[model samples]
Target chain A: MQTVSIDVGDDGTLSAVLRGELDFTQAARIVAAMEAAIDDCRPDSVRVDLAEVTFLDSSGIGALVRAMKAADQVNASFVVERPTLVVFDQLNTAGLVDVFGLRRA
Target chain B: MIPETDSGYLQRLAELEARVDQARLSPEILSERAAGLLAGRIGCRIDEAHAHLRLLAGQQNTSVASVAATVIGALEIRRSTSLRQVRHSVEEALRATDQEPDQPVRVSAPDASYSWLDVVQQMLNALPGKHIVVVPVRGDDGRITDYECVAVSPGMRDLSGRTGPQLIGMAISTAYPDIVGGPVWRAWADSLTDGHPRSVEPFTYVHIDNGDASEHLLTVRVRPVGPGLLNSWVMHDEQTRLAERIDQTERLGNLGYGEWDLITDTTVWSDGLYRIYERDPADGPLPRAESEALGLPEDEPLRRQAAEEFGRGETIDLTTRALINGKVKHLRAVIDTVRDAEGRPRKVYGIIQDVTARETSRRKLAEVERQLHEHQQDLAAEHRLAAQLQHIVLPIPETPVDLPGLRAAVRYLPAEQASRIGGDWFHAALAGDGSVVLAVGDVAGHGVQAAATMAQLRHTMAALTMTTTSQPAELLAHLNRLLLALGVSTAPATAVIVRWEPATHACTWSQAGHPPPLHARAGVAVELPRPAGPLLGGLAHAEYGTNSLDLAAGDILLLYTDGLVEHRERTLSEGTAPVADLMSRVTAERRDYPLDVLLAGLQRANPDDDTCLLAVRRTDCGNGHD
Candidate 1:
């Protein structure tokens, strides 16, 4: 299982940083927490930071896609940030790079 | 358990114990008795006999008393005049070793005890090489002239190779004409006159016969005693070279060879053998028991096997480990038995070598190679299991599905990687509401985890469809709630559910973040607008709307996942061309293409993803009746 920490910035940019494996085993738990964080904070913009995540499989990628869909439902702009090399490679393979605005910064 | 002793039994036990104590003889007392008997038989002083016995006891690594006891046993057995026959019989009885403490100390023959002539004969026999006693013959004037051959050992061979009794009564002049006035004759006169030992380092002798001559070099030692002279000789060239060569080979190859006489309990170890075992020559070579004890605990099986082979008189080749000087060494040995006429093992000869470095490194390399092979096998097994799971969870019906209310077909293609058995599945059955529920879903991800989630969702929806209503929009909404309840929010899935009523030929369907269902009519294909809904497990309390229409004959509905039409390098519009073109060709040509053919033609077969395709066609009333 992985833990998700959400920070609501002064500029209303809510960030949910995931730590630990984001594979199928931890996907459901991590995604639900991210959804809850978005609903409660209701920030104008959201940043999903995967800097501490050592692994992320396709199920984890699905969770990211789900988070984006849910963010759209709440009228929030979603930006994915600081994905590790492995997660970035998988995301690039799925051709979701520009769609999620994934960047090193 | 032993019973307690009564007073009478205890008294008797003590008396018997005292009798045993009185019967035991102290070392000095036993030595004195043996020495007195030896001195009386050999006619020597008892103190001289004791000193000789003590010296032999030290060399043989035994107590003086035991050596004395053995001497007494030999003398008592020697009542028979034939020395060789008596010695052999005594050795055989000693091999049984019942209550005998001095059996091992009898390895070497003790000097026979007798008078001067007998002592002289014993000394002659004791010399290691060929030797004979020559008594000088003198004229009335007492000048030494010729020598008489009084006694000879079998080892003393003349130029003609005559030995033993043949040369015993012969004169030296008859055997060797040139031997008179020779240097050997001078030595004989000097030894007899002075009664002291004399030696010539290298004496050259020539043999002349039929005009052929050969010279030989021999070192001679002569000692005068009583009325004759004792002599021994050694060759200067051939014998020394042969022995040195054999010694050279043994040391260089780390090889040792030895012989053990079972009857005498006497073992002989070559110098190489002594070096190989790191043994001190002073302590003497190992006896059978000491050598057997050197094996490590794990070598017990090898020892047992070798013993079994030895009993059969078969040669044994054994390799075993031994702890030597705090290091483990591998010892390889080949043993062969030398049996007597009666088929008993009289002696055993063995060749042994140390092969520790080669064997240890080979074992380690084999261990590493075995581990690498097992690791590769483990990976192959895991892949096979994952591939098996894919087939178990997502089973597609053959050709066309013949359900109660509809004729349908389903196809599922998994990712090419054996370990990536993906989750692409479908379910179709007649519901209790008299309508058929048709569904297709693709769970996100691959492998066991994805397959597990897909099975849960399919089973749950099947249960709901069997007992509950068969409505499209309501079913999608319920499934969305089910996903949230199951806590599968991380793995979103796309699905389309259809409810077909056979009574009115009406069909209604809805989607959950899935592509729109395709409707084909009379050679034309059009994508139906998807109902308003989000992907499952993403949004809570998400809404879904459905569109219903009455279907006539010759109409087809196709539902599929994104894998059936999407490619990474192309736009969505362009990727849809294959499906559209295949659909138009199938319907327009009236080619009577099976639903499987249409699906195979449309699917792009991506190696990185899974695909599911389901198709249903409205049948004519007459065809349905058939």
Candidate 2:
């Protein structure tokens, strides 16, 4: 029931803003949404805005790994943009914050 | 032995014989006691109860048990819980809808050891005009509490001749206040508690008809059904038989018959309708709006749909839920309209039924199904994650990895079990001394921990090859000491390393508890002679020695993890035979297929373990695919 908005840049960069919890169920739903955006925009770089994610678990980590892999297959760059402190800590715990290119707001 | 026999020996022999007699009882005695109890309960001869016991055993999916204690858990649960759990009789009764078209309908004796629910359903269908109900009597503190109406037949009416849709959850005390604290209540409660049927003699009871009192003779029958009581009543009079017929039909199906005049907003309800609403006859029927208010807030959309259909004067059938007396009940109703000549609604007639029992059971079944589906999804996710991790860490080379004088190809297969997350790895690289160092190793155990150990060993070994010489024996000896220094005795490893020099066509290899490498030449293949050495991480002081084998042109060498050749039933020699034969055959065939195909064809798919194979061959330069 939370909302996600995506914008595409001329250089094939997809900027997505996500709101609400990224728990297991919501993580699974976003995986499909991200896949659709990637397919439609064919973006070379994806920046995800997780500033509004109040909760995140292993499922969110899995989603990030999957997004990174999908971007790799398409030769695109994947970056985490404007992540909340909780989201940054979660990615760090999974040892993938650097792999996912998390950036400060 | 006979010559040594004495008086004490004889006495000891007698004691031993007595002890044997006191041991376990014979199976036959246990079965007989069980059959006796069953016979008494089922009202059948001992032999028939024994037969029923066997059928009950089969139905419960239990092998078998003794006579007395062999009551199926379902029966015990029904006896102890007052019929809250699913009962054998209930399952059979529910099957009435699926009964064969040709099956004859009959009501058997209550004690016949037959499917009572099936018989009840058939009988209820046969005589829809008859009023019947099964009630559970709960007693505590040495007194009979009120009865809960678990089931009801069509057309059951109260003293006021008003009908209720469902009596399943209604307390008998509320609906039949005249009978509470009376002789009939005592007889029914005692019958249920004692597990015996008792009859009530015909008695005169005063009935109020339209505010007028008259005496009527009533005969009541009560029969025990497990821990519940089944009741049947008859008024010994012919005058109201016509009205009683309609009430009987509605009572059997938990239906309410009612009519509403749209113009006056007046509602006339049968006794069944009052029961559905959990209301008192003294309070007159609820107006249309008050009746609609019984539904939960979420059911407003359904209320709106019904209103729109009514406005259009359309016949409507709706199934919804309502909170009556603070208890949620499923309510289904069918409505038809009498329109004036101008096509405006005039009068509405409806039949309502309560279906909460069926709905509750359905929701429980759905919850169980959802849990099972989620379990399967978790397993699939685990499997996918393991494969993804393997792809990240290993990522086998795309094609032949060209070394000094040899071109090597690798084949890797993961364990088929979804949980097999081990570290099975292989390494091939050119050393500083210009010799190609090839290695294959497996870490003990499985899961993320094993994989981590594997990564540590591989990266450490790769770093060591650059710093140390390409001498197979010296390198293995150092690796063994490192394993001991690391204190990983519990997580041991097996590895085979080969150092090949292109100019001399010579190979020096050392193995640490690994199967010796296989060598194929011309039309034959055989395992290379093994050098002496204990497994690495097995002991601190174990020494390793190198062995040399001359490489010939057109020869293929293979080093593999044990999974490639291990089988539960096959001996080491027997398991390795296929790989040896496959190499010779594939090398002989030459042009028919690629080496990858031959390697794949040679491996038997073993789901229990994983395998990693590195096949290296010295190829003469300037020769392509052929």
- Top model by lDDT, which number? 1
Pairs in steric clash, model 1: none
Q: lDDT by residue for model 2 over B222-297, one digit each (tens)?
A: 8775445667777777437857887887788888988976555567999888888888978988866688888889
| Model 2: per-residue Cα lDDT at residue B352 | 93
Q: Enumerate the candidates' DockQ scores in order.
A: 0.12, 0.01
Chain A vs native chain A, TM-score per candidate: 0.89, 0.87
Model 2 interface CAPRI class: incorrect
Shift in Å, residue B170, candidate 1:
60
- The lDDT per prediction is 0.71, 0.66
lDDT of 2 at B416: 72
Per-residue lDDT of candidate 2, residues A23-47 (tens digit) = 4346556777887788777788988
Query: Judged by DockQ, which candidate is best?
Result: 1
lDDT of 1 by residue, B467-523 (tens): 876887888788878777776344667678888888777888887766677777778
My TM-score estimates for the predictions, one after another, are 0.43, 0.42
User: Which ranges in model 2 have alpha carbons more than 4 Å from their true place?
Assistant: A1-105, B1-291, B310-315, B323-330, B335-389, B413-423, B432-435, B443-457, B468-494, B501-513, B529-555, B585-601, B605-610, B618-626
**DockQ agreement of candidate 1 with the native complex:** 0.12
